[model samples]
Target: MPSPSGENPWSIPENDRLSERDFGRIAELIGEHAGIKLPPTKRLMVEGRLRKRVRGLGHQSLADYCRFLFDGHGLTSELVHVIDAVTTNKTDFFREPTHFVALEEKIVPALLERHASPEPRIKLWSAACSNGAEVYTIAMVMAEIAARHRHLRFSVLGTDISTEMLEYAAQAIYPVAMVEPVPTALRNRYLMQGRAPSRRSEVRIVPELRNTACFARLNLMDTRYTIDRDVDVIFLRNVLIYFEKATQEAVVSRLVGHLRPGGFLILGHSESMIGSNLNLRQVAPAVFQKS
Candidate 1:
């Protein structure tokens, strides 16, 4: 039933009445702007994610929100929030544990052996590092390796397309429960408890760890990366599924160019490099070494 005074479509129970043409329009524009592809299979998901934004912005429907965004002369102001809502940002401590395993067991030792002389400077990039779980994980591993090496230094760089996510990454604060998956020894060494009773128990990354890592906003679609210097390793995991094949190849190629010779490039377990023409050799499943 409508309001006692009159009907209100904005008050309707369903906000998913997105038309086919509008879906295509929104998907195309998002791809053009953010390099995020919204296929037909994601039409429902896109609508669901946009509903809250549309309602929050006081639009009656997704169609209206799209019209406002596409037709308005200067709706660029709202585009940021729209992209933030649509982008995937789910991450956790030690996500895909195997990658970390391979990192510690195989990659680090090899890098250490290869650059054993003169105390090499280890540099790592966590591209699309949402909220910094991956960055911290890398830091922990480097800290362990450093504990033994004594002379080597490390710098971990975290980058993402979302400015909001980058802010959270820089903060390095998380609920205590979220960091449980991190090993106990590393936890004790690198994570400090947040001791305020008023707030729920949480953990802050130790200053030593935070100091070694930095965050930046970066869009992977760009032809040239702003970080021009060669990096020793790159952890670009679980982000390519959002792009088309051509995009995946392009991104992989770009990542390869930055890797110092024989540097490691780790992708999500499910992401592949079968046909990618990057100058990389598969050293392990989903782990490639620049040629």
Candidate 2:
């Protein structure tokens, strides 16, 4: 129904649309800062995502919000929020089951066999961990292995550019439906159900597994990463599709530098074409090993 002003209250005002110039500027900013492309076709998505920021800042339209962001000295404070708004963070527990199977059956045993120390530590990183699912899944696998192999120690690191996601990851809470992909045995071992009525639909990662994982905010576009250089495995999955080829190559190369010799680098199945030029050998589908 139309409002008293003779406009549809449920409809967005025409003036709220993002102008082409603003969209271009936003695209440029996001590309330069995050290495993720935002072509003209993504303008609607960008506009829709930024609407929350616009309303939060009390702006009447996209133009006003952009002006505040670009011209009125809001960029320094608003840039992270803008990037968070536009970034896509679709993920699931055990999104690709094969990757974990290979990690367990092949990667861990191989790394352990090559270790020189009597007690060795295996480190796994989730390079674009969205909400901690992948890292927790990794911890679960490692925990089960550690049960039998008393001399083995493992830690998992989950990193993403989104602080919001980092917070969510650190909280280690997830909706019941999101964890259905987890196996029954691992789920029973690593997950704890919420007891209260209002929280019954949620599950929290077991503290034992949570202690084995840590979360950090890291940007892939940076020339250097502050992470350790001796990581045993790095999961750079399901994220390269958002980058251009050059950015993909650069990010993959930098991540490879962090891997120890013989360490594994795993990409999403769809991103297998990337990193062929790097000093890596294909070990399995979507998996590479640094020499």
Candidate 3:
């Protein structure tokens, strides 16, 4: 059959093509376990992404991979890789520039004033932090704020379902092109150029900024998050668009419980509509504050 992309699955060698039945099973498992809705349109994409996994696992075909996963007890060990393969990690430093502007100009100052401690420690979370860009971005903003306000301290927690991404994020290295979105001044302040010739095309977040950031693997589909509940700002951006509406609301509601009173929740620009009923007030474009 011709897939949605107008490619005939049968045109590929039989061992490489994914059958309809196997695609359906894979879609069901991904939706059930990850809350990501993989409709028919995504079949070709999924099949393409999993081909490397099939070869890596020494499977002869997509069918054999499915059988190994479903019938041959490979799922328990392979599910994480499956999820990693499918979950899209589209992120860049300062991807949405205005969000950081608001964080630095408005949000952080407001939170600092409201905090009662002698030396306030602001807690920021990048809920679906992909490769640590968002977390490090937040750290850069917080570092600037802390410099001006001598009594302030901050920590950033970056969590993602992809252990693969979390590991990459922990390393804090990126192609020089990826850091281009960061402002020149902040880039100079927070990023260190690689000293070795082979690594010259890469930059690493400075040890000082890296020390303020931490990464962890967290499944948002899980009912409870094991991190701090007094988060001053939660950046749950972009990833929500991939979920069903009901799942979107459920995830946002749970995250809302983690925010301190007057703390902020920032969603992707497209996600503004989902959390209207959850004790939040729209404070900016896709930015919400807990009452």
Q: What are the TM-scores, per candidate, against the unseen true structure?
A: 0.87, 0.95, 0.95
lDDT (10s digit) by residue, model 1, range 1-291: 433224443655554456888889878877976788887877666777777888888888887887888787325798677777778887888988887888878888888888857888889999989999989999998888888888889999999988888999899998888898999999999998877785458889999999999998888888899984579899888898888888888888888788888798888888866324566778777888876
Better of 1 and 2 by TM-score: 2
lDDT of each: 0.83, 0.90, 0.90
- TM-score of predicted model 3? 0.95
- Model 3 scores worst on lDDT over the 10 consecutive residues at 1-10
* Candidate 3 lDDT over residue span 83-189, tens digit each: 99888889989988899999988898789789989899999999999899999999998899899999999999999989999999999999999999999999999
**Model 3 local distance difference test score:** 0.90
lDDT of 2 by residue, 130-166 (tens): 8888899889889999998999999999999998889
Query: In candidate 2, residue 14 scores what lDDT?
Result: 69
Greater TM-score among 1 and 3 belongs to 3
- Counting only residues 3 or more apart in sequence or on different chains, how many pairs clash (N, Cα, C under 3 Å) in candidate 2? 0
Candidate 2 regions with alpha-carbon error over 4 angstroms = 1-10
